[model samples]
Target: MKPSLHAKIHLWIMALIILVGLGLIAQGGYMQAKAHFAQFLIERAFEQTLVDNQPHKPWSWADTHPVAKMRLLQHNAQGGQQPLGQDLYVLAGASGRNLAFGPSLMLAGAGVGEQGNMIIAGHRDSHFMRLQYVNVGDMIELYSATGQLQVYQITATQVVHETATEVLDQTESSKLTLITCYPFDQLAGNAEYRYIVEATPLV
Candidate 1:
């Protein structure tokens, strides 16, 4: 006996739905794996730069280069006062492409450790996620490609409008600014503000 026309239509609809669902899942998984692999390459370049004191690109085709090494110093939670954790590699120029992999120095600012504002920016979800936990007086170590090492202590954290360029204004004293999109957990299309962390050289 032949199956009814309605039964055949229902079976076809179910098959289509399952195919679409599987495609979505596969795409999501592929994107996640790609992101992780990119990060791994960036970190490897950062370590190589530290050894050679030269700009190192994460891949042969990559335009971004590692410019500095940064480390956050926080006291141990237990009995000891010594700081823990490893160093991070900072990339040159905070363009959208450069920032996707790691923190990047803004080319418009003064050189790192120079007598002006030196700005760095990172994605709130990745490299800069720990910035919110940074506290006043916490020391940050910056190792430049010129074999210069400097320590800066966090002085304040503030929220500013995305258009506010005052944070990038020149200063007589050396200052370092770390910037990230505000509302770290937001999934909105455009971020309206920025999270700013200001630090000054430790005398």
Candidate 2:
């Protein structure tokens, strides 16, 4: 049976729409899978850094590597009991690709455990997602390649514009600064503000 011209055209349009929908789904799935794989590799490299006591790349061809390990401890309201959280890999630089996988230390700032302000940044979606749960008086521990562990207690959190530089100010005393995009739940292509977590060395 020969179909009418309009009928055939309608079927063709439907098929085209279906094909486009399928393609979008496939691309979304692939991106999601890739993101997960990247995170896994980043974590593996971080573990390698700890095991080797130095910077370690996730893959031979990768340009970024893990420079330190960070752990967080949250205490109860009573401040009597402390609950430890996951260990995160701290990478060397905050390039987009680096933050896509894990947290990164600002190369322009002092290194972890140094005598100046040490700035670190991570994606609010992944590595620093839990930062929202961090409270004043919480403890953060950073371990350097030389097996030196520096402990910092959270002092305050600030919400500031992305261009704010005061958070990275140099100081004589050692300080740890963690930065992430503000409004943790909002997913935007460009974030205009930042959530800054400040900590001071624990005596």
Q: What ranges in model 1 sit over 4 Å off? A: 1-18, 79-87, 146-148
What are the per-residue Cα lDDT tens digits for candidate 2 across 13-41? 99999999999999999989987787678
Which digits, one per residue and each the tens of the lDDT, describe model 1 over residues 1-203?
Answer: 89899999999999999999999999989978987888778777877776877778899999888777788886566743344345677888999988877789998997765789999998888778788777777888898876578998889999999899899888887999999998888847588989999989877
Q: Quick one: RMSD of model 2?
A: 3.0
All predictions: root-mean-square deviation over Cα?
3.1, 3.0
| TM-score of model 2 (CA atoms) | 0.81
- What C-alpha lDDT values do all the predictions have? 0.83, 0.85
Report how far off residue 172 is in candidate 1 (Å): 1.7
Steric clashes per prediction: 0, 0
